[model samples]
Structure formats: structure tokens, C-alpha cells
Target: MSTHRILIAGFGGQGVQFAGRLLAHVGMYVGKEVSYLSSYGPEMRGGTSNCSVQISDKFIASPLVLEPTELVVMNGPSLEKFEKTVVPGGRIYIDSSIVAKPAVRSDIEPHPIPATALAEEMGLGRLANVIFCGYLIKKLDLCPLSALPAILKEVVSAKRPELLEGNLQALALGFSM
Candidate 1:
């Protein structure tokens, strides 16, 4: 049982906090001790947003993540701000469609996923976060794939029940990538 500290960052509308929550929930659902913490600016859509998630087999001491073991960045600014925070030999997931530059560190593993472009191709641009979620789970081996659809069903709103299937599809697509 190892501990994982993850940081997800992007603009407000990019679902950075949502991604963090998804990971934390999945960790808890799988019987791991998990903590999720998030911060965002006043600007609703374009403001900087970030979340920290910690998962461990034992009790978690704190929710704060000063140095992340894993990281996901949806845009250039987030990449710049958080790339150095990733621990050496850790993994960094980047939304390649939005972030033009690569991480400066050479020790960490970088996975560049074209999430926005993939979402656009799927005709559901808003599903990029879900797709990234799928990719992250597969990359990190966080939880069983079967667990995600149930989690999606739980978190997705009743008002937009129609999106459940699409989100699942996006998740599958991302996992396959």
C-alpha cells in the first residue's frame, strides 16, 4: 500500500477540481484513505483552479499537497505553475492540445494527452475532463475500470442524465488512448 499525492490544475471551466474529486472518490470507494482539497479564483470560467488529492492505504495525515507525486495540467499556465512541483520519477499528465510547451524536468515521466482535441472529435468538448479521468486511471492503475461508470452515474447530475452515456464513451476512448 503506497501513498499517492496528485495535483490537478487548469482554468476554472476545465474541471480541475472535478477531476481531483473523481480520483479521491474512487480511492475511497476502493477502501483507501483519501483526501481532496481545492482552490479557485473568483473568476468563474477563466480563473486559475487547482486541487490536491492524497490517497494512501493508511490514514491520511493532511489534505494539503506541497509536492505532488502525480500531476495533471490542462493548460500552459498550470503546467508552468505545477510542473516543478512534481516529485522526481513521478508522472505528469498534460493536455497536449492546449499546452504547447513540455515540462522542464527530465526526471519525471510526462504523458501528453490531446484531451481537448479528442473531446472535440467526439462532438462533446466538455467531456475532456472525463476523458482525462479515464486516461489518468489507466495510467496510474488507480482503480478498476468497471468502477468508473458507477462513479460517473453517482456524480453526474439528474438534470443532465443524458450525458452519462457520453461520459462513459469518452472515458473508454481515453482509456484506449
Candidate 2:
């Protein structure tokens, strides 16, 4: 009986909602009860955005994640806004490339990854969110790595077929981290 309440936060164009959706899809594929809720500011592109995703073996009572077991922050403001919302002993994944600050709390575990830098180095700068997703997938053991390609195909092939290869590579790179 495992339950993960995950909150992903970043700028509107940083794919925060997409990452939440991906995690929700993964939970469904693995036969877990899931809930996803997305929120954003008035401005579409550069404004604040976030999404909460809950994955559990049992039923999910709500979509709001007040105390996340897992938190992923892609920018400094987001880190500041949501850092304290993580439960004690929970995990926080930070994009060190964009966020210069460190986690203030000592009780939670902080994983600082240069996801944006790594993705840029791989020539896949737009896929940083997916990179973070890959890292979360590996660290959380939410699903088998082998199952990711099929899932990626199912998610991205219809809308953006050309990005599948780069997304796959980004996931692999993040998993290796």
C-alpha cells in the first residue's frame, strides 16, 4: 500500500502540468488510483503554474495536495512557495540550473539536478520537465524503466510525433542521473 502525493511547480511554459499529467498516466497504467489537479496564474506563458498528482494503491479522496510527499520545483519562486509544503522526510527535486537557492528545511531530502542544463546540453532544452519526470520515475520506483517508452509513445506520438526521440533521450539521460 503505497501513496505518493506529488506537487510539481514552475513557470507556465515549463511543462509543470504536463509532468503531472504524465505521472497521472503512469499511475493509471500501473493500476493505481490517481488524481490530478492543475492551477495557473492569469498570464499563460510566463506566469506561475503548478499541478498536484496523487497516486495510491487505494482510493484518492481529493486532488488537492496540501502536504506533498514528493515536490518538484523548477524555479526559485516555486521552490520558495512550495518548499515548506513538503512533509517531513519527504523528497524535493530541484532544477539547479534555474533555481540558485537551496532548500531551507533540513528534515526533508533535497535532490538538486541540473535538469535544464542537462537537457540543453543534449539539445533538448524544451524537454527539461520530462527529464525531471524521468528522475522522479527512477527515484520513486513508480514504474519500470522498460515501460516508459511505450507510455511515452502513447502520450506524445499523436500530438507531437517528432519529439518522441528527443523525449526518450531526455528520459534516459535523467534516469542515468
Candidate 3:
């Protein structure tokens, strides 16, 4: 498999880390090399936060993504901050529900999704991250869509397995939208 660098960006508490974790887990589950790291400071919860994950069939040289192949912009400011760094032909997914007026350059492929709105519509106000993840999995074609339900099941608990079910529903919803 080719190396794929993915960046998930937003303010802290938006589940940026969780999304990255899921990606890393899926990569490893498929026997691919993966690195997942989240940037954190005292201000992370109130200020900016982001995570980087690299998935590859070969050895990865760096964990820091200087020119990511895919950027998941979970907020407007994040898109502004990272847009210039994305390489040409790279894919960008924006959470249009929370981010307004996401700017664009000519080279990147931007796929906007109303993640927060979708979560709220499903009565899952805290699941905007899940929605975005689903959309990313679909649009980026990160892995086979069949792998997503299993990924969610792997991350969620038996005590609340419906949460995983809901997440799978959200992923399917996002994928189809």
C-alpha cells in the first residue's frame, strides 16, 4: 500500500485525537505501518489542536506531516491555517457545520460536509467527530467501506454498543451524502 499522510485539525475537545486514533488502529489492523500523534499544550483545550497520522506499507521516515496527502479541516480557522501547506492534488475535507466560509486554493480537492449538523440531527451532539471520520473514510477511500463497522466496534464498548452502531450509521450517512 502507498503511504498516506492524513491530518485532522480543529480546536481541542472536537475528538481530533480520537479520529486519528481510529485511523491508526485501522492501519495497524490491516497490517500497515502507522504513526499517530496529537499536539497538545495547556491551551489545547481552549485553543487549537491537531493530529497527524501516516499509514504506509513501507517504513515511515517522519511522523510530522510537512506536506500531508489529505487534510481533514474540522474548523474554519484550521482550514485557513493549513490550506497553504497541502500539496497539489491533495484532498481536503471540511466540516461545514461548524466552519464557515472555508477558503480555497485552486490545487486541492475540497469536500465539505455538515458534520456537526448531521450529528445534531441524529441527536448526537457530541458525535460531530464521528461524522467527519465517516466522511473522510468515504471520500478519501481510506480503506474498504466494509472495514468501518468493524473499526467502530473495535473502538466502542459492549456496555454501549449502540454508540458504535450509531457511529456506523453516521459513517454510512456521511459516505452517502
Candidate with best TM-score: 2
- lDDT of prediction 3: 0.81
Query: Which candidate leads the pack in lDDT?
Result: 2
The 10 consecutive residues of candidate 3 with the worst lDDT sum are 133-142
Model 2 regions lying over 4 Å from their true place: 40-46
Q: Each candidate's lDDT (Cα)? A: 0.84, 0.88, 0.81
List RMSD in Å for every model shown: 1.8, 1.6, 2.0
lDDT (Cα, tens digit) per residue for candidate 1, span 54-128: 989988888888799889899899888888888899999999999999888999999998899989998976878
Clashes of each: 0, 0, 0
After superposition, candidate 3 runs with Cα above 4 Å error: 41-46, 157-162
Off by over 4 Å in 1: 40-46
Residue-level lDDT of model 3, residues 35-88, one tens digit each, is 988877564766888989998989989898878889988887888888888988
Instruction: Encode model 2's per-residue lDDT on 12-63: one tens digit a residue.
Output: 7888988898888888888889999987445345588889999998888989
- Screening candidate 1 with a backbone cut-off below 3 angstroms (N, C-alpha, C), the clashing residue pairs are none
Displacement of the residue 37 alpha carbon in candidate 1, Å:
0.6
Residue pairs in candidate 3 whose N, alpha carbon or C atoms collide under 3 angstroms: none
- At residue 125, give the lDDT of candidate 1: 65
Which candidate order results from sorting by lDDT in descending order? 2, 1, 3
